[model samples]
Target chain A: MSVTAIRETGHLPDLSRVPLVDEVGVEERSARFQTRSIKKESKVEALRMVLSMIDLTTLEGQDTPGKVQQLCQKAIHLHDAMPGLPHVAAVCVYPTMVGVAKKALGKNNIKVASVATAFPSGMAPRQIKLEETRIAVDEGADEIDMVISRGAFLQGDYGFVFDEIAAIREACGDAHLKVILETGELGTLDRVRRASVLAMHAGADFIKTSTGKIQPAATLPVTLVMLQAIRDYFYETGRMVGMKPAGGISSAKLAIHYLVMLRETLGAAWMTPAWYRFGASSLANDVLMQLRKQATGIYQSADYFSKD
Target chain B: MAGSTSRVPVEKTYKIYIDGKFPRTESGRFFPLEDSDGEVIANICRGSRKDFRNSVVAARKAFPGWSSASAYLRGQIIYRIAEMLEGRREQFIAELHLQGLSKRRAKKEVDATIDRLIYYAGWSDKYQQVFSAVNPVSSSHFNFSVMEATGVVSVLAPNESSLLGLVSNIVPAIVGGNTCVVLASEEMPLCAVSFAEVLHAADVPGGVVNILTGYREELTGQFASHMDVNAIIYCDSDTDVAKEIEISAADNIKRVVNRTNTDWAQEKSQNPYLIKETQETKTTWHPIGS
Candidate 1:
């Protein structure tokens, strides 16, 4: 249970010593982020930045190989009509679909991120979860997104959750590891902060907000607490951790709000796709519609955009 | 009797209604509404392009649930609108009179507006039956056509009559399951805002009907060109305005209807063709025995 066993996290503190989040302050802070106005050149620049930061996810139970390939194609050649647009940061999928996504996105700069640890409901045994990560890695995934066992964490078993994440990070090898807090299940902003610290200290390269399966996923307050956790982590260890808000962000305006929050909270250092991402499926189309609206001086339609 | 100050007159500021909320124009500008004597009665919101943009967002958000709702439910909602308007007939008449209409004509306009709502209510569930067809095919197939709502529609209400014109243009679009944003007459917007209250009480969902008070010249280009809007109902006369809408609408291949020639006061104002104007004919074929 020593810090040495938790990957290379040598300068980390135990969970009991990490500061607890103030719920009211986080709520008030999250509300204030939406009030700032981003327009004209700044708005166009933010829209383009948001387009590049997207993860372009498809995690349905009925996702077929054809569907994953189609999504990968969309990730590569988004709105060819609007030239000079940026490609999405990555293509996120379930462990079983990682091979299809990786093969279809051949030679492209976009990364393939696979969700493991029995995602959404992380209730599997430790051995099986490690094997799932190994398989996703063997299938050529560039990043591995592992979910923390909320049940164990909620029962005051922080050590178990920390060990499990470390084991998965070891299995990820050269691939980047993203730990999903699934903040919707954590109940309070305090627990969200605690869980975020635990994941980062256990060697998470990125901390994602949700599995996109639960309601109230990736809310602003939840994301703010996690971003603060990332900020505090960098202040101590001097190593930056990326962030991804996965669910309920389907519109261009809301996505821009998230970018604003990211810049204000974490500063300009983490603005790149390498440090921030949106794990979404429909968000790409909305951003494209807004881009087209800016280009043609008219409203755009889903009929004209490529169907995801 | 005790000496007292005379009662202060209560004047209402008519604002644009979008997403079921009464919000002032994002531009924060207003135009005065004058009585027959040219005295300022009140200042109505001069809705800007951003207001129209917000309304389109609301209409697009409301389009799916509305288009998928049962036809029987849509008919019931429109019927409820007629009931609500009937209760507010006097208020509408008084507002029309203040805007320079004669008492008799104001009453007639309110009456006609009520009848128009009921007319569309009846057709809400029956228009598909009358207009849809089972086509004869040359192959071993069963081919049939049905009317589908054309998503979000934008309407430029007629400037001639405040109450009847706004109701006539809006009822048909909602009856056919398409959500709409109507630009109320600049000269007479009181009845239009009051009608929004009637719609609010009638169980009609928000964003299904948004009324804006503004100059058509400023908003016409946006209404016709917005990519989210599926159709534009131009109910004004100026040939230049019509040309602008037609040209802007071509950017997205949006369906633009020129209903400016029709008189809203007559019996001919309420018809199924107005409903058809915002609906698409969707056809499906099935092999008889594959």
Candidate 2:
């Protein structure tokens, strides 16, 4: 496809060069109290709810292609068994296993996501990282997860990081790119907000937290900061960016609270999976267990699902 | 001849503490530490990067015991410092007054600083319980986790609340078992030096809490980018300065905590978990069976 034609036809907005407000409050109660109240869900509705917003990349043993495929199969099985199950937004795996997950999820519409840009560490060269992104997209991956070079961002080399992200976005072609800021390692909320702005401006479809490898992974404060970044980005540029809070999120109540925060902070426009997702592996079963308890009036152990 | 017969004793000025000893400036130069009213209160030695490096070396040497000290012991040490601070309330008040705080506000700030220390001290043992947990693994081995302090934290204390803000930021970090090297508030360095004295009196160890009074922009960049410093607390505003520090911190993936202008005082709980999160959780696993 011609570059001009691609640019003209792309549904993705030109978020490159968008400015973002980087400093905000960090109080948990302050963040929670800032949101408005909405109608509470009935227990039945809660039980019937499917939290499809999960990414399985950080699952301990699931780093290998075989493990990735097994995870896909399990997700497919869960989808079939629980008719009420919400289709998980995607099965995020490494680039090498994108085809494995894609084949396993055939016709299921479950996205095959791959982590690129030398994910986790993101210490690789820019050209190699961009090539990795292109390779992931070529491997039937529907979504590409890339990491910003924390070194560059921390060095005040924002331009270098911005250009690298822009290049990766071009390599992604039609595939969605979720830029992982690894917010836990970013330190302050201000930097997190700045990185979010840089990512969105450089054409990130969604901004994610953590590579799930850092000491401090995703926290509510950091997620709240990122969400506010998205809200402000939308307000300024008239373009909405998706938010995916990945890493260290494993509880049902916390997941619900995150959703509540999203709903209240960004309003109903961002409540859908298209705009918000939880990149987690262990969170789904907890959501399910909570849903089951809400339905049956008795809490069920996590053993209802396979421990493995 | 009659005038020469009589003499009065001269008051000795306090020296700047560097690497555990009071040191005169290498340049043999001193600046008149003045009150808000421009009255000279004392003479403070102007510190240099050499002094900073010396303090960092002292802090590095003390990290093993300080960073690995039991949370309970750390709490005890912090609370003792708080108690000692409370006893020296008059001194802090005087210093605060010298730094431009009104009498009532100085008293209040001193009280709050002590309370803040106690508050964080009380959290040393409990914060890990609150924030960390065991992962319910499908494995046979027992698994549990809690937050561990990152060693050798470097701090740039808030310029506004000189003593109280410096204490508020530094105490929580040490209470959570992190040794720190703080760049004291330039405008109000007396109280910080005094607080360091209080820590010494409270047996806070030689290098557990190192305080340096110097230029922020000049000294803080070195602290933030230092390969040895594990974390940085930027208590001052100046977004550009913070951005530079944060970007520099990325060199070692050092944690950075930038305190905004929000009223942290009105907030109910000053959980030590804020400091706790800046550290890593090292989860070690071994087969349970012998």
Candidate 3:
């Protein structure tokens, strides 16, 4: 007889055991969520909710302290001309800028999220990764966005990946840890689901889709698979893990669609910023524009808005 | 078998041209374009606020490249449009005839529109030379005032002279590097749609001249009120509706240009003044000795 289960069903975790997602089914379902008729009052309301859920991010290599300060100010006073608009949930920046962002934000309800551990590529040694996490946490980051070891994950070194996440979580202390799977590199939806489970089990407070540097990041199907994984994880552990579909989600319409997907897949409980977040840089301006349009009944211009 | 069977005639769907693609209105609402004899000619897409918004976006997106394009290149593009229109002469005239015009009158209109395009194409590179001037200033500086295209313009095409009036408004705006969203004449929209095809063939870049076939009453407020639109040109509209446009336009301080009761066939109609209306005058001063 041919030897099936060729790896001898060893200690290593096989992603084949993870629920096989029907690609077409997930796509069709994600598309259906987008088709929901959100207009006028409901649309304005959704825009407001989306504004509150944004993790206003600027993680470029060229990020300066001045830019971080400007971003923090924007998070606090988003469209002051409109009046009565809710600030974004957090200001996301590199670990080095977290202190500047936290200090600039000062006393505001907005949290500071910092990306650490050789972000966009989690390639450094585990000790250095943990040390980076400690620095960000010490610098007063309310949330820590860490990239996973894509090399390890792709090589099926699940234990190494899990252990690194747990170590980083321990270093995170009180700060919420957003484990970026960088699903754009993961290659498939099944891999995304498995990665989400591993991240959650290894102590991720949230599962993020990308590092905002890769192409085809945070696609609806990928986000849907990860959200489902979070849902199933919650079912088993009775603990909620947040979801942030970072990158390529720039439009107000797409943000609202994410909210719709969140509401339907995870229910109304996960609709808040506490459970759902959008890691975006330009999304805040678009939402603010939409809100002003709804208020004034006129399409807006980018010339009138401030760019951070 | 041939005598026993009757064939069903295939009809054309007159969709609005937006962003270089002929898609029906996002609203999915269409109104009938009927002939003077009350015959249903075609169901044209009734443009909604959403369509107007989408067109505005396209125009704004196209503005930078088209406006900054060298005057010589713009002249060539405008001339190319005329060339395309001349080639599609029979098509436009036939469309005009379909919209209730005799062959003689439709032929005249098509010829005039073609000539108008050529006239504007000639002025595209020369209008600035004629309009801009170097001023004698008190300061020890060389000062000059030149014309620049004012971003996106929303043109409400004339109710009558569907083809000629539509061409007249679009030519001057695009000649000056301003992109436009033109609302074609309601009852006689066939020629407008046909002209969009000419523009598409001419390689007049998409979004430079968006054509929509819909009632003015349904879209006037949106066209005037849209904050992104830099200007609104209402051709041959009534005082009350023009006043409403002027008022709605005030919210964004939009330039409301009135081209009412224009004799589009007149030689005087093709002039630099029309081109100057949609342009902003930039004054530059440089120290003479520096």
Candidate 4:
């Protein structure tokens, strides 16, 4: 027999015989435990947790360097005075303000994130987006959140969208690139998924749901679709992309539910701020309130933290 | 539930399907479609014959590397897609709800569709054993038959089952090594477009599976009669369309599969064998020299 025939008919390797980890037992038990957790999260804490994790951008329109510094200092004071402060993931700002956040967060280890890519509306040409991203990276922004060309993406110019992301990613170099899909305008969950995948494929370090500039931003369904895109990208490339549900995430309980969804759907690997972030400015106090309630079992008045 | 009557919003964009990327439609013409509620959704790019031709070119270009890829690797990619789908369940549910399915049914359908992908992903490497055999004819020569993936097949996914039927049909075809051109269900083309994102994530070779979302009746006949299509699968239950496609397929002796209202979920083996059956069998013989 010829070698080709021999190779074809040869005792095809017995793939089924390979010992697999007892996934049946693991899956069943995990499912059972997860179901209970899901119930607890869905019922007890989802709204509260989502409200707490805020992005904390532009506190009272402070454009001056000194004013931005004061804002960071105040944030630090809030962090210190409230022993039960809910852990806000990051303080997002323009590139110039990253240094102030970094200085204020010294030794605290809170992330210093910057928004790039012609913020609010991504109308600039590709080179301009790259330059803006480079400036953000130069400013010591730990993570760079950039917006996709809504015009391009909506125009069905996915190549332009993909190339834009890929170029911005190149400009980021070592800094993480968070590609925003701006799901509100994408208009459908299906479009969100498509955008999410496109971003991930083009080397997005994280996939964000919105720019917080449009109406109907940051719904759970949109976030869910983006997360799935990350998971699928990871499956295909063995690279786990992060998820950021920006725009309207204003509660600790809701943030926690997002975490719960991430944990249950993507497993433990995606639980940290590195993998998940909430972009909101007003959500911090609410998270603290709920955390305090969970801790001391007393409903603290909202004013207790507001006074600080 | 009262708000369920609200129409699912449609995207207003025109794009191309080239090398797994949904770029702007090459010819760049768009037509508007109305939702069940008769509200105009986004203007979908009306794909042209040139777009189809470009997609076929890309698919043909991508066929070699994709078909020759290791089955284990392919399985890994497909399994990753299942993981992604599971994570995005809420989105799928929401989209399906917008497509007019009840919330509970939508959730169930999305979940089942994801599971279906995992089922076929696991079978990427095993179908050859189940489908290929050596026949001992009473001659000095040895005859062995093996199934080779038909180069680039075209597909018409069912309109109703949107997500599940889309995956059910496409996964089997690609897993068995055939690259494809898929016409997304016209009524709910969003999921198919979204699935292209997942495929891109899995690093599926560009052109292995190309999707276009437009009116099926307008496009199906054109797709059916195309010369480049080596095989065509009509997942619709419309008998007349099926008959017409079967006849057109005879022009090129292209393989034709008319899928009925069968439940793909209940099938016994989620292997590539079913997909392989639609392809041509190549048998070779060699004499054992003395």
Q: Which pairs clash in the backbone of model 2?
A: A15-A201, A16-A201, A154-B247
What Cα-based lDDT does every candidate model obtain? 0.90, 0.75, 0.89, 0.71
For lDDT, candidate 1 versus 3, the one ahead is 1
Report, for all candidates in order, the number of backbone clashes: 1, 3, 0, 30
Q: What range of 10 consecutive residues in model 4 chain A has the weakest lDDT sum?
A: A4-13
Predicted candidate 1: what Cα RMSD to the true structure? 2.7
Point out where model 2 deviates above 4 Å: A1-24, A28-50, A58-62, A79-81, B1-290
Each model's interface RMSD (Å)? 1.4, 22.8, 0.6, 31.8
Better of 1 and 3 by DockQ: 3
TM-score of each: 0.94, 0.48, 0.95, 0.46
* lDDT tens digits by residue: candidate 1, B139-188: 98999999999999999988887889888889999999999999998888
Worst 10-residue stretch by lDDT in candidate 2 chain A?
Answer: A4-13
| Residue range with the least summed lDDT across 10 consecutive positions in model 1 chain B | B1-10
Better of 3 and 4 by lDDT: 3
TM-score ranking, best first: 3, 1, 2, 4
After superposition, the stretches of candidate 4 with alpha carbons farther than 4 Å from their true spots are: A1-308, B1-16, B265-273
Ranking by DockQ: 3, 1, 2, 4
Per DockQ, the best of the predicted structures is: 3
Candidate 2 lDDT over residue span A194-255, tens digit each: 88887887778899988888968888788888888889877867878898988878876667
Clashing pairs in 1: A299-B227
Instruction: For candidate 4, give the DockQ.
Output: 0.01
Fnat measured on candidate 4? 0.00
lDDT of 2: 0.75
Could you give candidate 3's per-residue lDDT for residues A19-70 as a string of tens digits? 9889999999999988899978999999999999999999888999999899
